[model samples]
Target: MNNLFLRNQLCVPVKGYNRAIIYDILRKDYFLIPKEHCAILDTNDFIQFDKIEDVEEREELIDFLVNEEIIFQLSTSEQKKHFKSLNRNFENPNPLTNVIIHSNIDFRFLDLIKDQYLLNLSIISQEIDDNLLAILQKVSELEIDSIYLYIENSNIEKLDEYKKLFANYSLIFSVNFFNSKKIIDKTQLSQNIYYNFFEEEFSTYKRTLSIDKLAINAEHFLEAYNFHSYYFAKVYIDENGNIKNGLNNLENFGCIKSLTSSQFKEIISSSNFKELGTIKKKETLVCCDCEYRYMCVDSRVPSKGKKHWFHQFECVYNPYLSKWSNEEGYLNLEESGVYISASGCTIDQEKLSENFDKIWNT
Candidate 1:
């Protein structure tokens, strides 16, 4: 699938630590793109294609998805047939112009040339099965523009294996934040080992680190990852918080914070961060009212009773927050007037297509 579709979305692991917390951040801050941004589609969303009946219905859905500019994954000939059924009327083309096939099917069946649709292989983490050699062999055959390597806390030691496997491909390492070290003590032996290991291995691969809760000083973390060129901030906060337009409130309150999306845009528009590429800033906004608003920058708050930061926003599993109840002390995001969320790591697919309309669209 095209990387553009999955640009702003966070692809999280269902089994990772603090999964609930991470997902909560996603629910509040991120909007879902349709089939065109196919890179972030999980197994559950892909299965929805099975329920789609008739070419017309499929085509309609595809039309809706195309506005989102996401690539849809059609793994089988049967799926492709369904897709083709919708495209019978070539006058109105299927919005989902890009199709991704991830099965172990022969490449000949794809019938795709370089000038046409893009093709990518879904490398299952388990499929690696401790066989580094097999993984490397498979990587050699892939014509993928990027490889997604799912890295877990337990598998940190095995990352070297992946580095060697996809040495030839442009690898985007997705690190799960379970047990992620929030504090790296250079003086400590364990920290030293990890720092050395990551500094060396991640030097070659474009690292995209996923964290459940952003650190207190998120900018520091961003710098630590070398601004990664790509990073997903999955920090959570309570829904019942005061909503503001910029970081002025926090700064006025004596907080040493970085620029907000609007500020960042102004800076970039004026040729600031020129060293950081021609960065374009886009934001999604949400509004809420709570006493902790100033301290909670963009709904990212430190976990209650724990000094360590944890997600406290719209979590599907956490029934105590917004999307569950509207009682005071609980989040009621639907009631919030305006909330701003930003993504600048990839191309502005939302602007390019209108399949998905979010709060920030206007």
Candidate 2:
């Protein structure tokens, strides 16, 4: 008890003054305690604190924090920090590559990522037309391993034609219907074309990184969490033939006619491009408190609501309350308080405003 010290963890404040969160990085657990109790974590030697004023039960909070490994006894005074290993590159020879190609009813001019064996492609099209076959043909030529076509399921008038055409490409294609569309056809489809079926709303998160995915890819994800992109390396050709960081992000990087895969990569790697993209859950508001932050597939371009950090307005989980709603939960993100735009952990006000301006003006 005497030798124990609070482990290095992340402390964040919820919007309301009532609650705050302490994320224990070592154990990958989070605790919601009173905002007043946050001072206990401020000092290196928490043992020096005798009383926490606002807390009704100080001992209880301490006991819970200790039990959660948020507080632990160090074996020595070394104060050493641990880092993740970077030795797995040699193991993955071919490497798994995923990309998204957004075409505005045209795929004839598409040319990017020509060399890599694409493991996945998510195509977002305004309408299904004759060019689709050309796109699929090009995909097959590119040796694209699998695909998920996002379109209005009900609007698919050529189901039979689609079945026949898609069958020829030999792609493991899934259809994601937006606008709350359901698979009404009731047709027993072949093994190749899978339906995007969600028994519940939480299942929607399965398409992104969720708990189940975290359990499987924890080690790999932990090492490469920064590379997580909501659009997943999208090379979008908007309806107007303009290219942006992603389909969700409107900031125009260049025109589809001029940009190449290599150029697209360079643009994304630039500071201006990264300023708008490359946000991880841990860097976000409430998402930082979740135990699954590292493993979760986060959104790069979520709806910009009232708060910069509260990107997921439809989120059901409330980390501060440690509760979830069947419907929309509280959406206030725990901002780092440094930036009015967002916390320092996320994009700053300067970068955010600049990107938005660039998107509108460009």
The collision pairs in model 2 are 209-297
Cα lDDT, all candidates: 0.27, 0.50
**lDDT (10s digit) by residue, model 2, range 1-362:** 45445444332222222346554434444455666666656554434345655454766766776676566665555642441223222122232255556544345334555666666777765446654556766676676768877653335455566667566656757765444335454334565676553323322433343333332232334333454434434345566666665545567877656766677557645666555344555556556555445444554465333444545343444343333443233222332121223332343456444543443356
Compare the candidates by lDDT and give the number of the best one: 2
Local accuracy of candidate 1 as per-residue lDDT tens digits, 294-337: 11223222122122122234322112122323233333332232
Point to the candidate with the largest TM-score.
2
- Candidate 1 global lDDT: 0.27
Per-residue error (Å), model 1, residue 234: 22
Candidate 1 segments exceeding 4 Å error: 1-122, 127-136, 158-330, 334-362
